[model samples]
Target chain A: SQTIHQWPATLVQPVGSPLSLECTVEGTSNPNLYWYRQAAGRGLQLLFYSIGIDQISSEVPQNLSASRPQDRQFILSSKKLLLSDSGFYLCAWRNGGILGDIQYFGAGTRLSVL
Target chain B: AQTVTQSQPEMSVQEAETVTLSCTYDTSESDYYLFWYKQPPSRQMILVIRQEAYKQQNATENRFSVNFQKAAKSFSLKISDSQLGDAAMYFCAYRSTFGNEKLTFGTGTRLTIIP
Candidate 1:
């Protein structure tokens, strides 16, 4: 079984502060990792996705950035956070092959930028 | 570009009743995939069901099933004997068969099961 871990579960950050959210997947190697944000009572917005290490594709232009340091370790970072950056951040992983790939999500990290 | 649409913004059903949530998508590709994800109050996105476009038979998982109409581009979810635990935001998602396809999600429909 594959499991994804994300932390800190919840964070309160002042505006313009640096931010870092980490996601690591165990029991799977070379998986496709994705970063998504969901606004209050709204649908999810894809921020970034990585197929492999050092290969990141950003869907939306924002203050946030994502990196795949290892085969199963992905990190979301920002040099300076904005008020609009506050949302529930989700890290998901899927199989890296041509089979029927279903994404498995982690318990999201809630960031409140005050 | 592929797009997903969930017509109902909110729906309510009594416990043990049945409810159908409508979903339609626009895609140019013949081979693709459609999925329904459930987001509970905890906000964890969980995969509820999935259907491959090339398949003729509708996909079913226990009390959950999908009506996949490839020509109509309609994929609707039917929840039978709805339980209180079924209350959540249901999102319709689409992914293309070609390339590194990313999922395009619909504006979810909030389902409330009245006990």
Candidate 2:
């Protein structure tokens, strides 16, 4: 069975502070990773996705960035956080094989920028 | 570009009753996948059901099932014997069969199960 682990389920930060949220997958290799943000009572917006190490695609211009350091390790980071950056961040992974592209999501992190 | 739409923002059903959440999508591609995800108050996404465009038979999982109308570009989820645990925000999503594993998600419909 595969499992995704996301850290710091909840965080409170001051404006302009740096942000780092980590996501790691177990029991899978070369999986496609994605980052999504959901504002209160709003739909989830795709932020970034990585196909492989050092390969990242930005869906929309924003303050956040994502990285795939290893086959199963993905990280979402920001040099400086904005008040608008506060929301629920989710990490998802899909297998690279020919199997159905069903994405598995992590627990998610709720960030509040004060 | 593909887009998903969940027309209902919120719906309510009495416990042990049945409810249907509507979802429709637009896509030029013929082969693709549609999914229904549930996000409870805890805010963790849980996959409820999935439907493939090529499959004619609707997919069902226990009490959850999807009505996939390819020509209508509609995929609606029906929950039978609804329970309080079924209360959550349900999202409809779409993904192409090839290239770009990114999922296009709808705004979501909040389901409330009354006791």
Candidate 3:
């Protein structure tokens, strides 16, 4: 069985503060990782995705960035947070190769930027 | 790029009754995948059902099923014997079968089950 862990479950950060969110997957190797954000009443938006270590693709231009340090470890970071950066962050992992469409999501982090 | 559309912003169904949620998508590819995800107040997204474009027979999981019309680009979810536990925000998503791993999601429809 594959499991994804994300933390801290909830975060409260002041403006211009640094942000770091970590996601790690156990029981799977070389899995594709993704970062998504959901606003209060809006749909989720894809922020970043990585095919392999050190290879990341960003969907939108924002203050947030993502990195894949290991095969199953992904991190989302920001040098300076903005008020608009507040939202629910989700980490997902998918099987690699052909036919890896279904994604398994982790418990999201509730980030409140005051 | 694939795009999913769930027009209904919100829907309500009485317990033990049936309800259908509408979903439409646009894509140039012949084969792809469609899915329904449920997000409760707890904010965890869970997969309810999935449909592959190549399969003509609709996929069913227990009380949940899909009416997939490939030509019409419509994939609707039918929940039989709906319960209060079924109340959640349902999201429709599309994924390319050709190789794209990214899933394009719809705005979602908030389903409220009345007691």
Which runs in model 1 stand beyond 4 Å of their true positions? none
**How close to the true structure is residue B62 of candidate 2, measured as C-alpha lDDT?**
99
lDDT of 1 by residue, B1-115 (tens): 7888898999999999999999999988899989999999988899999999899999999999999999999999999999999999999999887865488899999999999
Instruction: Score chain B of each candidate by TM-score.
Output: 0.98, 0.98, 0.98
Docking class of 3: medium
Per-residue CA lDDT of model 2 for A1-114, tens digit only, reads: 899999889999999999999999999889988999999998888899988899999998998888888889999999999999999999998887665678989999999999
Question: TM-scores, in order shown?
Answer: 0.97, 0.97, 0.97
Per-residue alpha-carbon lDDT of candidate 3 for residues A8-108, written as tens digits (9 for 90 to 100) = 99999999999999999999889999999999877788899998999999999999999998999999999999999999999998887749367888989
Tens digit of per-residue lDDT, candidate 3, span B1-115 = 7889999999999999999999999999999889999999989889999999999999999999999999999999999999999999999999888756678999999999999
Query: Which residue runs of candidate 3 sit more than 4 Å off their true CA positions?
Result: none
The CA lDDT at A12 in model 3 is 100
C-alpha RMSD (angstroms) for model 1? 1.0
DockQ score for model 1: 0.67
Can you give the DockQ of every candidate in the order shown?
0.67, 0.69, 0.65
Comparison by DockQ, 1 against 2, better one: 2
Interface RMSD of each: 1.4, 1.2, 1.2
Query: What is residue B33's positional error in candidate 2, in angstroms?
Result: 0.4
